[model samples]
Target chain A: MLAIRRTAPDPDGRLTGIEIADRPAPPRPDGWTTVRLKSASVNHSDLAAVRGPGFEPGTHRVLGIDGAGLDEDGNEVIVYPIVSGPGYADPLYDPDLRALSQGLDGTWAEEVHVPRANLIPKPAGLSWDHAACLGTAWLTAYRMLFGRADLKPGETVLVQGAGGGVSTALISLGVAAGLRVWVTSRDPDRGERAVTELGAHAAFSPGARLPEQVDAAMDATGRATFAHSLRSVRTGGRLVTAGAVTGGTTDLDLADLFIRSISLHGSAMGSPTDLRNLARHCATGGARPKIDSTWPLHDAKPGIARALAGDQFGKIVLHCA
Target chain B: MLAIRRTAPDPDGRLTGIEIADRPAPPRPDGWTTVRLKSASVNHSDLAAVRGPGFEPGTHRVLGIDGAGLDEDGNEVIVYPIVSGPGYADPLYDPDLRALSQGLDGTWAEEVHVPRANLIPKPAGLSWDHAACLGTAWLTAYRMLFGRADLKPGETVLVQGAGGGVSTALISLGVAAGLRVWVTSRDPDRGERAVTELGAHAAFSPGARLPEQVDAAMDATGRATFAHSLRSVRTGGRLVTAGAVTGGTTDLDLADLFIRSISLHGSAMGSPTDLRNLARHCATGGARPKIDSTWPLHDAKPGIARALAGDQFGKIVLHCA
Candidate 1:
């Protein structure tokens, strides 16, 4: 099996950070099954996994959290990465929760093993690449908008950082779900393209005031956009966050929180049910994941470099099979 | 009307900061009515208004937010300090929301004028002091626990800063609602008394690790207890805050937030309905507001000093008739 493995952490900003290696096919643990990967998408978590402390030192680890593949019986499946605890109905409540590439080998390979429960059937209409994107970024955006923020249709939402995988997903999904989707970007070109390509209602420069406050604001670009995200929502509105790419630490004014009656919900990747619902929504609603660029499994360096530089607009995928 | 008024903002620490003045009674605005005061309670917000920035300078503003008095019809009423906009069912959702002492002249006088809608009938079984306590601190605590956190009975909650008015309310309300209430205080005596007198399940020193994580953690002491509050809740739990007496600014680790799936809710003094529910709960549930000490309105200096020093374990009341 051909796998893209992170041999060393990318501390010094080196390009070609990953190496393609011929590895043995993934061994299926009891109750788990091996899937031959058809497509996989890169996420910021994959970049973090490549950048150190996410995996042990001196150990070559396969890197990717989002993938769509086929089981031994030739059934197409979208892999849910979050491994749940026994008897817990919601994986979010599981204390010992671990996600793929965090604690287990992930889906950046020709063959990967995952729990049987983690497999959701990929719809016939959903393409392999779009199904692959559903595992991480799309699912996160889905949960942030629908599951965590609980936004109603016809309400407004602001997506900070319009060019990233999650922001693109939020804009498309929010628009598909009947939300007035606004976005912000550092680059005006990206902001304009976000409206034209991803169906955002409008786009603004970072920190530019919106004409009206939104019911909810999604922030994944943490420190850079945290204050804007907080200010963008209306009173009693929600500020939902999943990741902080620029940095984590941000100043929070407690008075603004209480006086405005804001609810800040912090979400991670999502529950398996959320992934299933996301797949179903994308399949039935005709919403598709935007792909930035794709590279064959043997030559994933350019895709890795593009993702690391954040130079692309959407999910960077690899044709793994 | 005899009122405790702050004649000037206190930029520097000043003792006996407020003056008891013989002033004209508040003129009732259209659609507003006068409430002849019976009892009023001091909150940290009152102290803030006296200090600076919270209130307009040099306006001789009355300095209390929580009060119980008699309406023009001689009906005993608890003043709901948060004024709501017309047609908005939830006052918290009102963009022009302003609480007593923030934008309006507050309670602390022999008589104060308020919107007629801001008065909830004081339950017959409730004491004037306890009813007064409901307008601010107790209501904030009630909303933080019940409305914001949505805590179920039998869930555990940690109240940070055990001696303040809100902490006392949370301890009593949480206990009365069948929650396992834990408290933390800098003073060992206060912590011990919180357990013995306030019916807390346990008490710990500030930042001390609890035996187990709580389902919800309430914080009003901002910088001093913010980190501890974040650390005290279990994954997928809530940290609800209403005020930040110690300081407003705090460092938030965004990674810890999303990874743990914590919800941070900021609740101000609750709605009129919450005040009514709190009064009814205290009346029927046999829960009484803990009054630390009382002073006649003529000699409110010591009470103000005690509250400013954070020396009291419960509400500081001004006996006005």
Candidate 2:
């Protein structure tokens, strides 16, 4: 079986020691079953494993957090990225909580072993590529917008950084849910495209003074956009964040936060339940993930390069067929 | 009648421009009446007017934010510190929202002209000094705990600073509300006193690791304690702030905040309705603000000095008889 693995971590360079090699098929654990991969999306976390601090240091590990596949029964499904033990009140708080690639053989292989419970039935109308997007980034955006922020229809949301997977998902998902979605981008082209192409209500240059503060602001770009996100919200508004791809530590004006009655919530990826709801949301709204490019699993370096160069507008996926 | 006023704006020194001078009593406006102030609490905001930026520059205004007094009809009352125009939904959001000292003659006088609606009935059992405490700092603490944080009883809350008016009030009010309150202090004596005297469940040194994470953390100490407050809460825990006395700007690790699903909420003083409920909470629980020291209105310098020096355990009051 062909597997994409981070053979070694590159602290200072991109694609330091990635291996596209042949390996014996992995055996499934009890209550787990084999799924033949149809498609798997390349995520920032996948890049982080090879380019930054690998989750399991010194050990080579396969590196995909999400995928669409066919179960043993031939049912098409999307693997829930997070792998946690059962009966936990909320899997998010599970002591052993971790994304798919963290502890198990990941989904970026021809055949992968995953918990049966993680196999969510992909909607009949959705394609494998879109289903592949639901397990991580899309699910994160779904939770941050709906479950974490409790944003409602007709309310306004400001999205900081208009180009990333989570940010683009937020704009599209929010728009489909009847939210007034505003986006900010340092690149004028991206900002303009966000309004003209992504169904955003408005778009502005990063940190530009808004006509009026928004009901909430979403930022996954972290330090680069955090200050602007803080300043963009109305009093008693919500600010939600997922990954801080730029920088993590940023200055916060405590008085501005408290005096304005703003609530900032930190969120990571979502629960299996959230992933299921995200699929329903996308299916119901006829919305789909934006795929920047796709490549065969054996030839994924070019797609990875596009993501590393920050040239992709949305997800970069690899097809396993 | 003698009134405590900021006769001149002092940008550098404490009490530098404060005046305990004789002035004619103030007149009431339409829809307003005179309240003969029995007692007034000196707040941090008062010292700020002389030492930092006064809310309204070039205005030699009276300095108090909260007062307990008798209405013209001899009805005992405590003036809600906020004075805003009528018909505005959520006075906190009102454009005309200002504290008693901001745009009007403050309550640190023999007689203050206030809106009829700003008067909350003083409980018969609450002392004049305690009644004075309910209008600003106490009300702010009340709102931070009950209104902003939505902290349920039996949940543990961490108070970042063990002293200061709001911190002390948080301790007392939270304990009375059936919460398990923990406190942190730089001063060992204060930390010890918090547990022995203020009914706090436990105390820790600033930035000291807790035995376990708390459900919520309260911080008004600002830059000095913001990081500790951010680190002390449980996953998805709430961090509520009112005033940032130390400094307003502090570094926030967005990854720590978002990855753990923590919520940080910014809040100012409570609304008039909150003020009324605060008074009732104090009265019903038989809880009262700790009066650190008391002074007559004519000789309020010592009380002011205690607050400015951060030597007081709770509130400083000036009585006008």
Candidate 3:
């Protein structure tokens, strides 16, 4: 099978980690079956796993977290990325939780193995590219907004760092759900496009004071925009985080956090229920995951590079089969 | 009328900022009525107001936040300390939320003037000292456990600092409400007392590993205990904070917060509804605010000194006649 695997560290900003090569077919375990992967997408998690603590010199970890595919029984489905850590606990809370590429071979290949439970029927008419995006970044945005923050229609949500996959997903989903969506970006162009093209009500320069504090906020850019996002939420509002690309740690002004009754919720990916709802939402013309660009399976390197450099404005996809 | 007022900062820790002296009787304005204060209790807010940004050397701010007294109609009542900031908005959310001493005169005097709505009838069996403790610290604790964290009976709650007013109130109220209460304190004696005297199920040294993560936590110790409190809650659990005596900033490890779905809620005091509910709960003997000691109204200087020194373990009372 043709696949993408992480080969080394990009620690010093070399960006020389990914390898597109042929790999063995994934074997079926007791409850696992193979899917003929049709498409996959790049999430920061994929790029981050390589950028951070890289694989041991000899280890070539296969590299995708989510995908859309045809199951062994010929059913079209979206694969749930989490490999159901021991005890079937929520993957985010499990100390041993592993997404597709974390421990097992991922769906970047032509064929991949997933538990039967990981397969959710892909609604007819939802594209393989869009369905491929759902299980990781899109689902993360879903959980952060609806699951963790419990946002309501007609309320406002501020999304920080406009170009990332999750940020775009948040804007699209937030707007689709009848929210007053606002987004922020370091790049004026990205912020403008978010408003003009992504249905965001408004956009602003990073750290530029928002027109008003929002009912909730979404953050994936950690150290840089965290304090601003915290400040941008109205009193008693919440901010949900999925990934921290710039850095992880932030100074928590306890007075600001508690005195204003602000709450911050850290999110990873969605639960099974969130996944179902996300699929239903997308199928029902609710929102679409913006596709930055798509490449053939053999041409994944460039797509991964664009995503890894954080230059892409929407989810970057690979047509696997 | 005799009252305790803050005259200056104890920035050097001299603890001489408080003065007990005779003052003019409180004047009732339109929409306001005089409450002949029978008892007032010392809270961290009173101690903190002096310890932090103190008043002008020439200015004297009457020092108590909550009190039990007689209304103009000679009706026995517990005075709501919040002065109904500006638009009568939620005091916690109001930028101009002045809780008594923050702007106008507070409750630590023989007679206090407040809005007519400030009075909740004192239950015949409830002691004045206990009722006096409710509006600030006890109410803060109630809002933290119930209003903010939404903690439930039969669940476990961890109190980060067991000796302070809010911490003790959390312990007593949580236990009385059928929760499993656990407390932490730097002093071995305080930890032991919280378990033995305050009905906590267990006690731990600060940052000590708990037998299990709690469903919720209450924090007022700020920078000192905030991180540990964040780490002590189970996944999707909450921590409510009311004050930060040990300094106000802390490192928020966003990963620890979101990956575990931990939520931190900053609470100031209770809502009017929460105040009424707290009174009903206390009237039904759900919990009693621990009274560390009592002093005659004229001897308030010593009580203020004890509270400011952080040597007292519970609510300190000024018995005004």
Against the reference, the lDDT scores of all candidates come to: 0.86, 0.84, 0.82
**TM-score of chain B taken alone, candidate 1:** 0.88
Q: What is the lDDT of residue B67 in candidate 3?
A: 88
- Candidates 1 and 2 compared by TM-score, better number: 1
- State the lDDT of candidate 2 residue by residue for B1-321, as single tens digits: 788878776776567788888977666678788889999987777777757765465656887888989999999998987776666545675645777877778988898888888888998878898999887778889989998788899899999888777888899899999999999999999989989988999999999999998889999999888888888887768899787889998888888987787778888888878888888889899778888888999988888888877888678889987
What does DockQ give for each predicted structure? 0.64, 0.52, 0.48
How would the docking of model 3 be graded?
acceptable
Q: Candidates ranked by lDDT, best first?
A: 1, 2, 3
Model 1 whole-model lDDT (C-alpha atoms): 0.86
For residues B1-321, could you state the per-residue lDDT of candidate 3 as single tens digits?
Answer: 788777778765455777788877656678888888999988766777867874766778787788898987888899888765554346566655667887778888888888887788888778998888899778888989988888888889999987777788899889888899999989999889998888999999999999998888888888988878888888768888777888897887787776776777778887777887898888885588878899888877777778777788677898888
- The estimated TM-scores of all candidates read 0.83, 0.82, 0.83
TM-score of chain A of 1: 0.90
Which fraction of the native contacts appears in each prediction? 0.82, 0.79, 0.65
Chain A only: TM-score per candidate? 0.90, 0.91, 0.88
**Candidate 2 at residue B40, lDDT?**
91
